[model samples]
Target: MGHFKLLDVFAGCGGMTRGFLDDGEFVSVGAVEVDRSAAATYAANFDPTGGHTFAGDIADYTNVPRADLVIGGPPCQGFSALGKRDPEDVRNQLWREFVRVVRESDARMFVFENVDRFAKTPEFELLRTAASNGGELADFRTQVFRLNAADFGTPQKRIRTIIIGSRIGPVVEPPVTHAKNPIGDVLRWVSLRDAFLAGPVVLEPGVRDEWFPESTADFQNFQVPGPFKLRDLHVTRRYDLTSEIRYAHIAPGKSRLQLPVELQYPCWRKNPAGASDVLGRLRWDQPAVTIRTEFFKPEKGRFLHPQWENGGEQVNRALTHAEAAVVQGFDERHVWHGTKAEIARQIGNAVPPPLARAVAGVVADRLQAG
Candidate 1:
């Protein structure tokens, strides 16, 4: 069977695009992205023909070519748990553009991804109705499901909502391909310990590039290689004396809730029950919390290492870019460009590639069977 052509919308650093292509059953024909950093990252990894990766707003994008499949995860900040779910956020309207492209592209199948909370919004139903009643997707069957990356072997418990549409057959959700740390039928969830090993490992520039090479072949088969350690990493951010002293009291899996009365921040002290993850440390035995953009800062959430002893010093630091990438289901070979913040945003905003691969596998099976 010929490879299915894929058009990726809101293709931030080509996570979904890479995921689909990694299966070796789909080829990305075009991608639309507005962020230059992300767009550059996309170009670095994908070899889309005709330079079809538009590094601009989707609103201005036109003359899009039809494809066999359309896949994307639009800007989900509006529906995310981190921010105010303001109904008036402009990013919310991007879904309309997604539908417009899907309709115009006349793709046989489409996969739309977003935060799990997106399902509760009125637009969820609106988009479904629009896709079902109008344009090329008029007869397309649609299914909406909330899926966890952990279910597909990612070491982070990032939950996302995926909406699938298919005219070829009923859109079926991908089966859970991996159980957590499997020990003979007792399927335990994949833990942070499973994704990254303890590392005081320093990453030299040449070694980092070698591990995460720029070839699609490398990216496709990318793993940490033998004796896996974090690379393409970030320096541990230093904390102020007061913050350091406070953090010293927290243990693995514990947060400010266990801090001494004097160590609690004023806001947390006033509302002791609030912001449960502040100053929290992750448990090595469990999967990580969702790898948010702010995961580099230990104060942001439970981003701290469980117990990484660095050169005989007991240091608690947040996940490095490489560690966070692995936790998000990206292999060591997936490279990112630009500032640390820009790279973190790209990684955080992405659908776990393994999760995307699972979805793409189902779509590919249906398309091939036809």
Candidate 2:
């Protein structure tokens, strides 16, 4: 079959496109990313010539080059539970640009990704209704799927809403290859210990990031050329002894609630039932919770490394950038560019390549049938 040409809009370090290319079925024709650093990161790996990469507003994308498919949607920060959920947030309606791209590109298919809460927003309702009739998306048959990254083999359980529109045929949810409860051939979810613990971690930077001639497995989901070294591997924070004591008090899979009243912060004790995962230690045997942009800060979520709370190696630090990147399904080959904070944002905002690869399979089947 002929390879499909792809256009990625609002592309964050080309995560979704990376998955598509990895599937060996699609090649990106052009990509639009407003963030200069992110676009640079995407280019660092895929578009070195600066050709076919657009690092500007999507609204200026007139006369879009024709492609077989379009992927990516503006992030749903406005609709995210973490956000203010402001009805007047301009970002909420940027889906219009996504629709415009699909229509103008005249692509046979498109895939839109967003936070799970986006489906509950009125904006999503508008998009859904328009896709069905009386709009540019009328030619396409659209389906909504709520997918968890862990279900598709990612070590992190990130639940995102996927909207697939195909002019050719109905789109189905990608089959889950991994499950918490394995039934028959389905494998169990990949555990953090399996993905992050086997390697020799450097507390500081390495001389250089080693790139082998071919793929090698350090982690099952993401294999980099070398082990975790400086760049992100050593991107750790220095929590004082007092804070260390607090983390030590929380056992694996446990949170601040475990701290005695005297040790607990007043807020934690006051709302014992609230934010159960705040200042929580990660469980070595389980899939990770969603890795947010500020994963470097342990107080934000359950990001602490699986240190022996009572005894063993002093793994008291939070998940380093390398571990979090791998858990997000970005292989070692995935090049990232930007400041420490910028890199973290790009990683946190990205789609897990494993999940996107599964979606690619679904899109490929539809395109082939059409």
Candidate 3:
């Protein structure tokens, strides 16, 4: 009975569920996700029987089971900083469904996650107003929190909006367990260099740090340890000679802005001052930037492998799937059930398990105390 049951609404491939499971204090009762491929992936890993899962729009789902905690968020495309931030985007209205399910589930508490920009949007205010105006969500007094994935253990700096609401009483917030260059017991922010859980690689701001176990050959040849092995996910990509030269121009810790005039994309050459992250390369000694849906493409974000200024074997490639999974907080043991693109999207959209585990711990403690 102490094992709190969980209902994961809008669950995206069980990222949040993974956290709760990792916390060892909760059990999944059900999960709902729109993308059938994603839902299949979630079910394969978390709901193999398919009896407690729904793979459709939240509006059409009515099998809300009673649980101690309900966690999820609507699609955040509208509020994502990577998008146009269109207030009129239909996805913005999905929060209404979240509120509806929360009301029906009769859960003691709920956690909502979204892009950081969601906190500032009009839709957020609408949800807040429902809580304040004695609407369906009124019984659940809500508070908003901001959390970063790196602070919770993931090797990427993915910041997100977290809103915790409870009908049982006020909910406690999350804890920050890591920091930049942490001193004593707290861990330093993990960087790409430490993605494999390698030894401490901290260095002065501009100093170029070499990979750990200097005897190891190179980034591409290295295998992800057994503990982090992923099934059915590969990050191998082919590149043309011209693209390779463009990547070479993107030195470690740098971007397409460093490319010479000819190497720059036509659009990039015209808009030199636009995005600095385009065609970017990652730094070995620092946490990665957010891994967006198209992380396989270096032109999309900082998805490139680090290279010495003098050049190396990995200079022309992007992060491998194992590398991206570890940095994004995923274990390879869970079998996947989607196309490569869908799987990539799931990884990009997931709430890092480490962060989710931290939040789940806080909630479980509060429920136990009560």
- Alpha-carbon lDDT, every model: 0.73, 0.77, 0.75
| lDDT accuracy of residue 95 in candidate 3 | 76
Model 3 lDDT at residue 300: 86
The residue-by-residue lDDT of candidate 1 on 1-370, one tens digit each, is 2379899999997778767887889988888888876776776667523277787899888978889899988877644344434556566568778878887888888999988888876667666776666643577888888898888877888889999888888756787855665555545677776666632333221211312223222222232111222354544565678877776677877887888988877787788788889878887778898988888788789887766333444455666677677778777556565566777798888888988988988889988976
Residues 38-68, candidate 2, lDDT per residue (tens digit)? 7777766677676788878898878588999
lDDT of 3 by residue, 1-370 (tens): 2389999988987888998888999988988888876777677677767778888888888878998898996777744343334656566557778888888888888998988888887777777877775677877788898999999878899999998887777756777788886867788887777764463322112222122111111112222212112532444567789998888777877888898898777887677799888888988888899988888788888888775567345557776555676778776555555556776787788889999999998888877876
With candidate 2 superimposed using the best TM-score fit, by how many Å does residue 249's alpha carbon deviate from the native?
1.2
Ranking by lDDT: 2, 3, 1
Ranking, TM-score, top scorer first:
2, 3, 1
TM-score per model over all chains: 0.84, 0.87, 0.86
Model 1, poorest ten-residue lDDT window?
Answer: 204-213
Q: Which residue pairs show collisions in model 2?
A: 205-230, 206-230
Question: For candidate 3, what is the lDDT?
Answer: 0.75
**lDDT of model number 1:** 0.73
